[model samples]
Target: MDRGHVDAPEGLLRIEDCLDADGNVVLPAGVTLISLIDRNIANVGDTVAYRYLDYSRSAQPAVFELTWTQLGERLRAIAAHVQRSAARGDRVAILAPQGLDYITGFFAAIKAGTIAVPLFAPELPGHAERLDTALGDSQPALVLTTAAAADSVRGFLAKLPSARQPRLLVIDDIPDSSGADFVETVVDVDDVSHLQYTSGSTRPPAGVEITHRAVGTNLIQMILSIDLLDRNTHGVSWLPLYHDMGLSMIGFPTVYGGHSTLLSPTAFIRRPQRWIRALSDASRDGHVITAAPNFAYEWTAARGVPDAGDDIDLSNVVMIIGSEPVSADAITTFSEAFAPHGLPPTAFKPSYGIAEATLFVATIAPTAQPTVIRLDREQLAQGIAQEAGEGADAVTQVSCGQVARSLWAVIADPATGGELPDGRIGEIWLHGNNVGRGYWGQPQESRRVFGAKLTHRRSEGSHAVGVPADGVWLRTGDLGFYRGGELYVAGRLADIVVLDGRTLYPHDIEQTAADSSSLVRRGYVAAFTVPANQMPGATTQDTTEQLVVIAERAAGTSRSDPATAIAAIRSAVFRRHGVEAADVRLLPAGGIPRTTSGKLARRACRAEYLSDALRLR
Candidate 1:
C-alpha cells in the first residue's frame, strides 16, 4: 500500500501551517477545542454549561451549577497549577469521581497542553486493577483527584513503587488565580489532546491518542449528523465521566453552546426513574438529549415510573441507547412502557461508537424511529443476512444508521483484508479525519490496529466517495453488515463461538440464559469458549471447543439449588440456539466483572475463571 501524502482539498486547514516560529500553535479561526471553549465563554458566558446533582449531601439532592465563564476560569487556574509540574505534551491523569472537579481537571489538563487520561477513581469497587494498568500504560507525570478521594488515591499510590508513583493534585485544594497572570498554552490542531483508554471488555486496555483535530471534527460531525445545530438542545446524562460516551454527552453540549444536566450513575442505578425525571425536567426549557447503554433502558422499563403521572413528557427528548448490543426488544419495551407518559417511539435513537473515533459514529436520524430488521438466524450464522420468512426462525437486529457523512465505513473480510459487498458479514472498517492518531506507546500494536488498507477492488456496493487510494482505515474488531443503506452490528469477531462447525454469538446465548429464570441477573452473564484441552477431563481427540457459561444470581433470591438454575440455563441454551453448555457456574451478586462503562469484561472474567478466582456457589 502506498504511504505517500495525498493532497487534501483546497482551503482545508492543516495543523503544520498553523504553528508559529516559537513552535507554539497560532490559533486559527475555529480549529481546536480551546477555540470553541473561548468562543462559548465570550458569546454565552452566562449560559449554564453544566448542572450536577450530589446525592451524597442530604436526603434531597444538592445541586451544583457551572456556567461557561466559571468553567473557563476554573480551567485556567487548574491549568496554571498543572503546568508548574508538567511540561507541554506530558500526560496528566484524572482520578476523581463523577462531579464538577473531574470536569474541571479534564479541561484544565487540555488547556495546559497535557494529554488528559480520565480514569475511574480508586474508591470504586474493582477499579484498582484497571487504574493500575492505565497508570502504567499512560505513565502520567501528575495525577488529579478530588479532596474526598485524595487520601484513597494516595494510599493506592503508596502500594506502587516510588519510581512509578506520580505527584497527586487535589482539585478542591487548587486556589483561585483569576487575578494571577498566567500565559495560556498555545494549542495546535494536531497536538495530542487526551488519551482515552479503551474499556477492556475483550482485551487489555490501550490508550487511544486522540488529537485536537479529531475531537473538534467529531463534535462537528455529531452536531451535523444529529441536526442539533438548529434546535435548542439541552443535555441530561447518568453515565460515568470516565467513559467517552458520558464525556461526550456532557462535553459536546457545551461545545455546541447548550446546557447539560448530569446525575450521578449511582443515583440512576439506585432508581432508574432519576434519569427519566432529569430529562423530563430539562425538557421544560428546551429539547433534551440523553444517552446510556442498552441495559439501562431495560432496567428502566422493568421498573416503570407508574406514579410519574402526566408530568413526564419525553416528547421533546432524543434518547440515545448505545455502548453495547442494541436490542430491538429493549427499545420496544421501553417505548411501550413510557408511551402513556408521552414518550414517542421516534425518540429512541440507536447509535454505534467507539473510543478510537472520539465517540459519535453512526446514529439513526433524529426524525425517524430506529429501523429493526428481521433476519433468519441460520442465514446470519452463515455470514449472510437474509430476510426471514413469516414463521421462520428469525432474529431482530436494530440498524445503527448510515455512517456519518464525515466518515467512511466499509465491511472488510478480516482474514483477507479485502472489502466485502453489502449484506455480507465481515469486519467493520472506518476511515475519517475523526479517527485518532493511534494507540499510545505500542507502536507495533498501533500500526496493526489503525493502519489497515483495503487491497481488493469491489465491483458493486456502496463505496465511500473521494476515499484516497491508500488511506489508513481503523479496523473496528466488530463484525457487521450494511443492509438497506444502514449498518447492522452482528457481534465482536473475537466473541463469536464456533461449535459443531457452526457459529454462535455470545449475546444470543446470554440473552437466552437471562430469560430462562428471574433469579438470573440480566446483563451480568458471560458466555465464552475454552479449549477442550483446558477442561478438567478431555482427551486429545476432543478437538471441539468447550462452552462455559458464568452467570450472576439476582439479589435476595432463595435459589440455593444450583442444579435447578444450571438445568434451566442448559435447557434455554439448547432450546433457543441448539447448543449445550459444557459448564455452568452461578455466583453471588456482583460476581461477574464489568468495565467502568458497564460492559461485560468477558476476557477478564474468563481469565479469572480459568485461574479459579471466581466465587462459585
Candidate 2:
C-alpha cells in the first residue's frame, strides 16, 4: 500500500499538508483509503473516529462512539468474514439500515478487496423497485447486513431467483477476535472501490464504477476546496448512507483523521430540529461541516427554526446545499430563519456534483456567500442568461461556483458536442482524476457519457489543474452556463418541456404552480410534458408537447371547490411561464414520486400520469 500525495498549487494546501493531531503529515504519495485507515489507526487510534446517533428505541438519541482502533478492528473482523465468501473484485451488496453497521459493512467490503454496492434495506418504502434494479444489475456475490435487518434482507432476496441470490453475512454477528486472522489484501490505486448507482432522477439507475484513485483524489479535492485543513474539523450529516453525497462523509473524516457524527435520514425527517441540534453539538469542539439538499434547508427553516432555542449557535458552521437543483429561495429562507440563531450568510455553500465524478465537481468557496442572480425569464427560455432588472419576469439562478482544484469543467453543446462560451447554457462536461471508471455493465453508455471529447477547440481561463493529454470529459446531462468565472446550473436536458418551439424548464413551471395555490405542497410538484395523443383533445400530427403538472395537496389542506385551485394553477403557469397547462392532477400528500435521495422523479411521475396510476384527491 502507498500513501498518496497531491501536487497542489503553490498557495493551496497539499494532501500531505493536512496534519494529524500531533501536527505531523502522515499521508504519502499514491495512498488508498485502506492505507489511510491504517495511518489513522497508527497515529490517532485513541481518538474518536465516528459517532453515530442511535434513535431506534427512544425519543432522545443515544450516541455511540468508535475509536480508530475500534473501527479498524471491526473492519478487519467483517472483512475477514467477507473474504471467506467473496473473492477480490466481486460485488458485495450492503443491505443494512443506516447506522454504524452500514458503515462497517461498506468499508469491510472495500477492505476485503471487493466492490461494495451501498444500498438501503428492502423495508424502506417506495424504493423496492430501485433496490431491485440495482441488485439485478450488480449481481453481488455476497450480502452484508445487520442482525436486526437479516429478516428483511432474506425476504427481499427470496423474491429473486435462487441463482441470483447472494450469501448473507451478519456484520454484528462477527466477533472482534476474528480480526486476528485478518490478512491484508494488496489494492492498486485504480482498483474499483465501489459501485455508486445513479439516483434515477432523469433515467434508470446505472452502476457508476468508482475507483480507489478517484475516491482518494475526490476526498483531497473536497478537503482543499472546503478549506477544512484544521485537525478539529467535525462533520454532521443526516443523509442516507447509500447516496453518493452521503457516502462522502465516511472518507472525508478518514482523510484528515477527524471525527464525523452521523444521523439517520428518518430521524431528521421526523424532527428536522435534530439536524440543527447535531450541528450545534458538533460545533462545541471545532468548526462544523455539513451538507443536505435544497429541500432539507427549506424544511428545516420552515419546521425547525421556529422551535429552535436561543442558545442554538450556528456561527461556526459551513453547510453545503447540493445533491439536487440548488434553490436561491431556499438558501435565503434558511439563512434568514437561522440568522437569529447565529447562522452566517456565508454558511450557505451551494455545490454541484454527479455520481460519475465520485460525488464532487464544483462548489462555492468555503468563505464566500452563495451567489444569486435574476435572469430574464423569456430570454432564458431561449437559451440565454441575460440579467433581469426589477420585474416579475425574472428567474433567480444560483451560482455553483468554480470547479475543484484538480478538476476541469466546461459547458458544451448537447447535440454537437461543441464547446459553448460564457453565458450559454449547455451540458456540463467534466475532466479529472476523480471521474469514475465507467458504468459497470454498459460499455456503450460508458463511452457515450464518460468518454466525450470536445468538438470545438479549448478555451482559456480555467481555474483547474491542467488535464492529461489522454483525458476524456464526462458529459453531465444537467444543463448549465459559465458567467464571470462561475457556473450556474439551468436544469436537466431530459426534463425540459418544449411547447410551441419554446423550451420550458419544469422546475420553473413547478414553482409557479406550487405558489399559485396554498393548497399545493411546495417542493412536491412535478412538471413534465405529455404527448399530444395523451392529452384530452389533440391531433396525431400535432407533433407538439403539452405541459402537465402533477401536484401534491398540502397536508391538512382542503378546497371547498377543487376547480378553483386548478384554475389558479393553470392561470399562474400561463401568466408566469406563458404556457397553458393541458392537465393539472392534484393528489393527496406524498403523491409525487421521488428518488431515494428525495429528488422529484418527473419522468416516473409522467409515466404514472400517462398510465392513470395516480388517484385524485
Candidate 3:
C-alpha cells in the first residue's frame, strides 16, 4: 500500500559523470577497454576507490587502501608490463581468486588493450578440460596467479605440452620481471576486453567473448540500480570477484560510484556473521550497502537460532538477493531473525538479473521493506501471479525491487514470444542498455537467448536488436510475472513440472522444502526435469512425468534417501502448491552440481542423477 519513488540521483553520480564538461562520454576517437573504469574514477580525483582487506599473518601486515590515484598508477604499471611480455590482442588469463591484485590485473589488461580472462581458482577442478581447451583455443599470452594459487596453476600447466602452454605471471611470487614501463597504449570500444567462460557446472567450460561495451554497460547499470551514487554507501560483498556479479558489483561499482569498498573473503566465509558484523562495525560513520544471494541470508538466519540476539546487528545491511531464485522465506527469516539486533525487514533487497545483462537488471527500492506474495502454486505456474486469499497457500512477497532506473522488463509467452498481461506467469524478458553483446564463440547459442533480433520503443529511443528477428526484446528464460510496476520471479520455466496435467514451477517445491527444517540448506534443493521416456522400458506415463529434485540433506540430519526426502518434499508441496515432486535426493555437501559461482546446475545434476553415477547416502 505504501509506494514512493526513491529520491532521484543528483549530479556527479550519474552515468554521465564519465563525460567531460562538454558532455562527451568517452575520450573521443579511441578509448581503450582497460581505462574505461579507471579513467572515469580518476577524473573525480583522489577519491577512495578500493579498500583491500589484507589478512597476511605477518606481524606488520595491515589493511591496504588504494585510491583512484594509485589505481591509475597500478594500471599504468601493468599496462607497461603487458607491452614487454605479451602482445596487445593476446588474452591474459587471471588464474586466481578475488583480491586487490585481481582488480589491478583486470584493469592492467584493459589498459594495455589486451583481453583478460578471470578464472575462478577453486573452479579449476571443473575446468581442467576447459583449461586444456582454452589453452588450445585462445592460446593465452600469460597466466596471472596469486602466490597461494600460483603453484596450482603451475602444476596444471606442467601437464600441458610446452608448445601449448602460456607464460605464468605470479603477483605474490613474482620473479625478476618488471611491470612498470609501458604506460602509453591505445584501445577501442569494439576491441575485446575479456573472455568469459561458460558457467561450466558440467563439462569443460567454453570461452565467451566479453567486449568492452558488454562489461561497461553492466557496470553502468549496476551503479545506478544499487544507488551506489550515494556518497555514504560503503560496498561490502562476499561474492567472488572471478564471477560477473562479484567483479561488477564489488569491483566495478567502487570505480564508478567513487566510494570506499571493503573486500574480505575470509571474514565472510570463516564467520558468515561477519558480513552483518562488518556493517555493524562501520555503522557509526555511514551504513554499508552490500549484496549476496538469498542463501547468505539463510546462512545467517540459522545463526540467529543459536546466537539469538547475543551479538548480531544488521541495521546497516541492505543485502541484495539475486543470481538465483529469490526465496521469500529466506527474506522473512533473515528479517525477523535479525529484528532483535536492530535490522529492519526493509534492509532485505530481492532483485533479478543475469550475466548476459552484465549483473543487475532490476532492484527494488528501500520503501516498503521487503514484500513477499503468497501465491497459489497452480495459478502461478500456469503463467499467473494471482495473490491467494488468507486461507490459500502463498509465497513470501519479498519482491525483487522495482525496475532499476532505466531498465525495462516484460513477461512473455515462452513459445509465441508475445508479451503476457499482468498477473500472467511467463518468461521475463529484459530490455535495456545493460544487455551484453552476446556469447563469445557460440553465435548460435547467443542467438538462442539474445535471439537473432529484438525491437523496442521508449523515450530513450526505439531500436532493433540482433539480426532481423532478434529485436528489442531479450528473452531471460526465467519464469515470472509483472504487475503493479514491479517484477516477481516464480522460477525457471525449464525447471517446471506438468505432473498429471497441472503445471508447477520448481521454485514452488523448492520453497516448500526450504520452509521446512527437515530439508537441507535452504538452498540444498535443486529441481530439474529429465525425459522419463529415455528409458527403453518406460511408457508415456513415465515419459511425460518429468522432474526429479536433488535435495542435499541438511547437514547432520538423518533420514537420508530419495524416498524419505521425496515423500516429505512431495507431501509438503502437495499440501502447499498442490503438486508432487517426483524425486527429492538427500546428498552430502558438494553432491549437487553448482556453477563456479555457486548457482544450482540443475541441468548437469539431472544428467548425473540419471546416469546413476550420483548416489544418495
Candidate 4:
C-alpha cells in the first residue's frame, strides 16, 4: 500500500495521495470518495449532486435534483436501514431500476460499510439467468429495491432457494429523518467497497473486488487523464449505473464536486435524443462530459443528433467513446454530423478500460482528435501493428490513447510472458493502485488473472515507470499493442478465431457479414469458430477449425428473404477474409446472446449454437 520510492508522472497526481502507507483512505481532507462527498456537503451543500431525468411512466421526462446535503441525508437514512439487516464487509445487492432510488441504494450499501453489488432489476427482459447467477455468486446478505418494485422483486426472490434469498428492503420506504440514528463505520482504503461484475461476454460474470483505494485512485486518475478536475465540468450519462463505465460517470462528478445528470439506459435506447438534449442542457451550466459505447454513438449520430436541429449547442461537450472497440468510421460520421451544431473537432475521446481496473486506464488527450491508424491486415494477423502501405490490404484501428499517470501497462507475449516491443500485439498486463484486488470469492482464478508477473526483459521499451514493487500485474485478457505512446486494442484474446495458421478478429468478420445484406441486423452478428469435426460432412481427419456465422434479421423484414441474406453473408465472409463459412444461421431479431451491457457474447453464442439452442429462422 505504501508504493514507496516510485517516480510520479509529470503533471499527474500521485496514487499515494489517496492511499497512505497503512492502506487506509486519506480522509477528512477529501481524498477518498466518502470524504469528498462529506467535503462537498460542508463546502457546497446547496450545489446539485445528482439530477435524475425520470421517464418511467410518461413520454415527457420529469427531472429531479438532489443537492449534496439532500443526497447525504437520503443515503444515510437508507444506510441505517441497510445496516440493520447487513453487517460490515457483507454483500448488499441493489436490484432496482435506474433512477434516484438506484443511486441512493448503491451509496447506502457503501455507507453501511457493506460491499455494494450494483445489479439490474429482475424485470429487465432477457437477463433473468444473469440476475440469478450474480445473486447466487455474490450471495448478498441483504437486497435493496424501491417500493414500486417490491412485489415483483419479492416474487423473483421466492423462486430462488430459501438460503440464496437475501433479506429485501424497500429503499423508498426509508425516511430521511432516520439519518439521526445512523452510526458511522470507519473503513480502510484497502477494504472492499464494491463488487463490479464483469459483462460475462466470454465467461460467467465474476465480481471484481474493488477496494476503496482502487476506486479513489481510479477517480483521481480519470480526473487527471481527462482534465475534468474543474469544478464546472458537468456529467451526462444514459448508461446503466450497474456497469463500470456508467459507475465511473457518476463517481467522477461526485468526487470532483461537479453536477451529474443521469437517465436510464432504456430511456436512451428508446430515444437517444434524450441523451443529446441532456448534453445540451448540461453544457449551458459548464463543460459537458459524457461516455458511451461505440454503437451508441453510431445510433445517436445517425438517429438522434440529426434530429437535434439548430438550437442544440455541443461546443463544450467531451464525449468518451469506449466499452467496446472504437470504430474510426463511427467517430468520423458522428463528428461530421454534429459539427454544424457547435460540436468541436476534438470532442470525441476514444478510451480503453475494464471493470477490473475500476473503469479508466487510458484516454485521448482533451484537445486532440481521435486518432486512427491503418494496419496491414496480414501483419496484424501475425501479431504486429505496422501501418499499411497504400493500396494494400488494410485494417483501420482507432488509438485508445496513452496510459494513465500512475499505471504501467506492458504488452507481453501471452505464451512466453515476455514483454513485447512496440508495434507487437500481445496481452495487456497492467500494474497500478487503480487495479482492483481480484475477483470476489474465487482465489484460484483471481490469482491466475490478477497475480501475473512480467518475465525480466533487458531490452529497451520493456521497463517503464510506475511499476509496482511487488512485481505483480493484472492480465487484462485483452489483446493490444503500444505504438508511439498510444494503445491500439486489436481484439479480445479469447475471441480470436484461428484457421489455417491465420488469426481472425470476430468483430471484423461480424461487421463484414452485417454489411453484406440490409436485412441483417448490423450490430447483432456473431462470428466464431467451431471444430471441423463438430460440423456435418467432416471426416475424422478434418481436425482443423471452421468459421460459423450467426446473424439476426432486422425486425419487420418479412419482405426480405432469409435465404438471400444468408447467401450474402456467406459470400461476404469468403470475400473479405478468404474463409468459407462452414455454417451460416439466420435468426429472428434478438436471437444472438448479449451481455447486460449490450455486448455480443460470442462465447455464449457459440455454446448455444453447439447445443442447437438458437431460434433459427
Q: Supply the TM-score for candidate 3.
A: 0.84
Q: Each candidate: what lDDT?
A: 0.82, 0.85, 0.64, 0.84
For candidate 1, lDDT tens digit of each residue in 48-96?
8888988876646799999989988898888888998788889999998
Query: What digit string (tens of lDDT, one per residue) describes model 2 on residues 288-373?
Result: 89989878988998888746344687878889989456998888888888898878778878899899999998889876998989
Candidates' TM-scores?
Answer: 0.93, 0.94, 0.84, 0.93
lDDT of 3 by residue, 1-617 (tens): 11222332332234564445743233223433455454545465466677665444542225666676767677666666666678878888887766778877777777776788877563345546545666566678888777888778888878878887888876644322344466566677667777766565433465656666556555655555655555555676667766766666545544444444555554565566655655666554455677777666777777523354456555656677785568766777777777777777667678887766666777787645666667765576555677888777665554776765445676667777665666777777876555666666668867777752322322222122221344455676677766676777777666677776677766656667765546566686776666777522355555555667667767666554546556777677668765555556677766877666666777677767777757742
By TM-score, the better pick of 2 and 3 is 2
- For model 4, the superposed segments whose C-alpha errors exceed 4 Å read 1-30, 306-310, 468-470, 535-543, 554-556
Return the candidate ranking by lDDT, descending: 2, 4, 1, 3
Query: Which candidate gets the maximum lDDT versus the true structure?
Result: 2
The whole-model C-alpha lDDT of candidate 3 against the native structure comes to: 0.64
How many pairs of residues collide in model 2?
8
Error of 4 at 436 (Å): 0.5
Output the better candidate (1/2) by lDDT: 2
Model 3 poorest 10 in a row by lDDT: 458-467
